[model samples]
Target: MQKLSPVPYGSLIFAPMEGITDEAFRKTILKLYPEWDYLATDFLRVPSAGKYPLKHLVTHFGKELSDVGWVKDKTMFQILTSHRSFTVEMVKDVAQLGYPWMDINLGCPSNTVTKNGGGSSLLLDLNTLRSLIKNIRENFPGRLTAKIRTGFHDTSGFKDSIRLLNDEGIEMITVHGRTRDMMYKVPAEWNYIEEAVKISQVPIVGNGDIWCSADVDRMLKETGCHAVMVARGALKFPWMAQTYKRGFREETSHERLQKIKEFFQEYRTQLESESISLRGLLKQSKSVSRYMLDGVENGEAIRRKLLLSQTPPDFFDILKSL
Candidate 1:
């Protein structure tokens, strides 16, 4: 139950990415590098129309949730939903499950998610978004947050949406500076995010395309944001958080890869010691190995070999050859 240090502007955080940012991965990143200050879990889906009991939101209990008991204070439970009634119910469910804070996701751009009146699509209907925040504030007992994009198609529509959430007393806001339509195809618009900061009452956290400490510095300088959330950039380089803290000095290609390999070896041993099944463990390795090959020649070939292998030995053989 220890709290993380003061984050007026907060600090670098690992954004929740499904299939990639699980308990095991978080632990690996934290263990190897203790510089990351916050982490949002991959969102839990909420059923609509009150068809499902709220207990579904507590599904993390005793499973992945337990993995966070040691560091629960630094964690934020992310939920995907745009319904006021559903969000309120889900908030109650999360609090009852012992979660201290919850974050609402409104930035996901997946076609399926948007089609359901959830995710970024909510920006198109500010009333529902307002109602969702107002009701959660009125009923939910714990901290509430919203993670939003600039807008779905045009960012101009989100100004009022962000203002209303701030007015509703939401604790914090995370803005990825792109319209949902842009997806991850373009660089995040730091200027648009700066505009949100000007209008918002609550603390605003800026997200998108921050790859290193210099990117972090640029984000703060360009947008005057309180903090940043790293997604793909963190996945491509696990040491990014540490790199930010130490100041951005370019690491030689060879030095970078060597450090990554040593860390991967530590991660491998931890998986083995836990008695995790080889296949399940290997699945994670394949994803992590890409980052491990930063400077190696034809690293794709190395990744392909690891992808085909079923055992740790098979994957290690490919890594050793590199």
Candidate 2:
């Protein structure tokens, strides 16, 4: 087992969620809770064919995403793929874009992804995983990492799977306890994550079912992982990363309300900075605000207002009214 220095590696991480970690969302989180170890971009789909060029792919990074500056330094640019050639070809462009780190995703459980022999499906083939990481290292020339589930169906390949990553010089690895079959239905098997921490030659970031600071401590205590990754937790409680830095203190109702107001204000500010259509900006803000406003007293009512908001001013009006 290995431990990384307590910089970004030893710090708490925001997981790369598909629709949740876009540019506006990342910016909002950074503004509110800048203590996060790093913010990861949602996985960029590396198509085996067709026009998956930088222009198309960059859109998912959203507007303000960059290789440097803001939101913690370890901003990971993650990709999902099964085809080596296509992934290799895309890696060149990714590196050229100046992204500091690139992650091979073997953790997403979507059928659309797995059925295409990407995502967790790659777990069933260690040789291919090794080859892809090796190819990426030889070609990309940047910090390389991979996020993986326990395995496709079980933990059978778990040890060798992480070994391939470490052996290939992957800088860090995040292990989500559920296999592809688990698909997040079951609790993330942290004991399995403990196993990875036991034998992994590189730093392991544990993921799954971590919803609070207590859970963070539990993951770290039980697994001795180098760090923890929070996904759904960050969505519902945007201040979660703050807990890691300052220790967990329950948010009072007044504090929650204040946080909500501040969060949306940042959201509006970020959207305006992007210079997108008001309609598009409202749609984007509403899309993410629902999570931030979750569990609040008037959450549903606010969501309804956002739904009715047709322009940026309307959106800001609703937020103000809240």
Q: Estimate the overall C-alpha local distance difference test score of candidate 2.
A: 0.79
Q: Give lDDT per model, in order.
A: 0.75, 0.79
**Candidate 2: where is the Cα deviation over 4 Å?**
1-9, 50-72, 298-316
Error of 2 at 2 (Å): 22
TM-score of each: 0.87, 0.88
Model 2 over residues 1-322: C-alpha lDDT tens digits? 0222333445788899887787877878777888887778999887767547676656666545664344224678888888533877788887776665778898888888888888999899888777877888887776788899999988899999988888998888899999899887988899888998888887899999887778888898899998899988887777887866787786865677777778878877787787768777877777667666667777778778878877878878776765
How many angstroms is residue 126 displaced in model 1 relative to the true structure, after the best TM-score fit? 0.7
Please give, for residues 17-73, the per-residue lDDT of candidate 1 as tens digits. Answer: 876666667667778877888777788777775635544544442245444664566
Work out candidate 2's RMSD over C-alphas: 3.4
Clashes in candidate 2: how many?
Answer: 0
How close is each model in CA RMSD to the real structure? 3.1, 3.4
